[model samples]
Target: MNTMTLWHISGWGFAALAFAALLVGFSKTAVSGANTVSLAIFAAVLPARASTGVLLPVLIAGDVLAVLTYRRHAHWPTLWRLFPAVAAGVVVGTLFLVWADDGVVRTSIGAILLLMAGVTLWRRRRAESADGADEPDAVTSRAGRMKARSYGVLGGFTTMVANAGGPVMSMYLLSAGFRKLGFLGTSAFFFLIVNVSKVPFSAGLGLIDGRSLLLDAALAVFVVPGALFGKWAVNRINQRLFEQLVIAATVVGGVQLLLR
Candidate 1:
């Protein structure tokens, strides 16, 4: 498909894509896991396999904005420890993509999203039950390293397959006791690096092409306003309410994908 062919989407379809792109920016800055909704939207609108490629550039755009917004707060030690495991996961995800058909990919991503949502909910409840006790530092402990590796591999795989790494990383950071700025900062840099690295793999898979790039070009502009809005609202928004909304959206998106 050429550029013009890609423009053959209906007005409603384009609207949905634009909204999803906006959510990508919002998720990057304000809420890390919320873009799972955007993932669902893209997959529903475009071919399941191809949506991953098209959404990657948009995610990177948001990552850039996020890093710029929260660059100073990142903890480099954590990022370094996770990279090796993440690389292995990325390789595995690429291989899986090579063999999986559209139906399989769609169902797998849907299942993954729902599972992540459930995990997040469980973790949150557990933390609350523990009365938010101060846990050991995840950056320094041996156990922390083990946990990082586990989350790292999963994060890399989910991201490569479905652009759903945000939730996995969010859970890890929360478990590590990262405050808001630190979490956003580390996540921003992490995704910028990972998503950029996925470009060649996505292209090799025939998921990134002229047609997808054309659509991306049109959709990326919407991300800017969404990002700016998120930046402005981040400090003022009620954290509990915002988190609940994000999880609810994820659940809805997951159900849609599974039922579609």
Candidate 2:
């Protein structure tokens, strides 16, 4: 047997990739706030641009599973506001990919993740004290539409750039009073469409090709079980605790990205 493999693929690299794939699948499909960990792990192992490209296909695979699992529970209005802004953000991110330097990319992604983490943590703390229970806030009234839009715009930009948008969008949905199924379903649809939309863009940029695609295929398999686990965990977890866990994961992920 060969002791070494191409790119050290059999060593820590594959192990890292596997772990990242597991997290990506889980975060994309269900637990929303686990994105920060996925981002850090993938970036650590792969080139930054390549990491996004390789991970997008795996994310789409997970999104497919999420859609299947949560199709009936989606809140259409939440998606309506979020998708358009997110699409616009993707356009902006594509432009950045075309022109920005590495420093710009790093700073932008780190900042966005940090901001999302901050918001998630702050809201969770307030919700804990104010409600004495973890309920989606009463932010969905007509009065809350403006607030939601504001959140949507930021979430779109962050997600488009780094796939770091989950925690951002998750906080919005939670604050807007979406409960478990509604939040999961809305996220499923949102990411499913967005990740699919990124295919041609990533290709055009040459971020994904033969090797990346093959790697994606292997990683996609993990997403199925990760997502299923997320769905099952959702059933047993307290709504408040679940939300808090996501937020905590988000904070950790965001900080790691920033520090890295």
Candidate 3:
């Protein structure tokens, strides 16, 4: 499709896409897993393959805001440890996309998101039960190099295929005992780097185009307000509430994708 084609979307379609864009920004800064809603919305509004392209620029815009807001809090060592594995996973995902049609891609992503959401909830429950009512604000790092790499690979694969990396990374960060700021900061940096990395791959696959760029430009305006709101909200929220919201959004978004 050409640039003019995207401009023909109805007012309601634009409204939904704009809302999804807002969610993208909010998720980046406040609730990390919440962007899964944006992913599902984009898919619903556009073709599955085309939606990924349209959403990439918006995600990167959110990532930029997240980095600017949380750059100082990032943990570089952990990010460094995960990079190699993430690269491998991205390559594998790109190869998979080569043969997979939209139906295959959509169904596979839905199933994976559902499974990951279940795992995240299960882990959270176990952690809460084990730690008791007075759980520490910070979790001790249980992520060895192997485990980190595993999460990294899954994160890369999911992000590449469906922009569903947030939940995967959220689980990993939570497991490693990252609290609110640390989780946001580290995630902000990780996605900034990784999402930018996907640009060439996306272009090579013809996933991004002038039409998507036109839509993205319109959607980008809402990101700033959403991000500011998220920045404000994140500071006031307690840890348990934050985790619960993220898990709920992930599960709900996963189910939406499955049913779609």
The model with the greatest lDDT is: 1
lDDT of 3 by residue, 177-216 (tens): 6766888898999999999999999888888887678778
Q: After superposition, how far is residue 145 of candidate 2 from its true place, in Å?
A: 4.5
lDDT of 2 at 143: 59
RMSD of every candidate to native, in Å, equals 2.3, 4.7, 3.8
TM-score of each: 0.93, 0.83, 0.87
For candidate 2, lDDT tens digit of each residue in 1-260? 11111133557887787777787667655567676767766665665556667777877887888899889988776677667667777877788787865556665666765676687777677655543323444546665677666766666566656767776677677666676677788888988888898788878877778777788888877777788777777667565766666566556655665676
Poorly placed runs, candidate 1 (over 4 Å): 1-8, 126-140
lDDT of 1 by residue, 188-246 (tens): 99999999999999989888887778788899999999899899989987867777877
Q: Ten residues in a row with the worst lDDT in model 2?
A: 1-10
Better of 1 and 3 by lDDT: 1
* Clashing residue pairs in candidate 1 (N, C-alpha, C atoms within 3 angstroms): none
Candidate 3 TM-score, C-alpha based: 0.87
Q: How accurate is candidate 1 locally (lDDT)?
A: 0.85
Off by over 4 Å in 3: 1-8, 126-143, 238-253
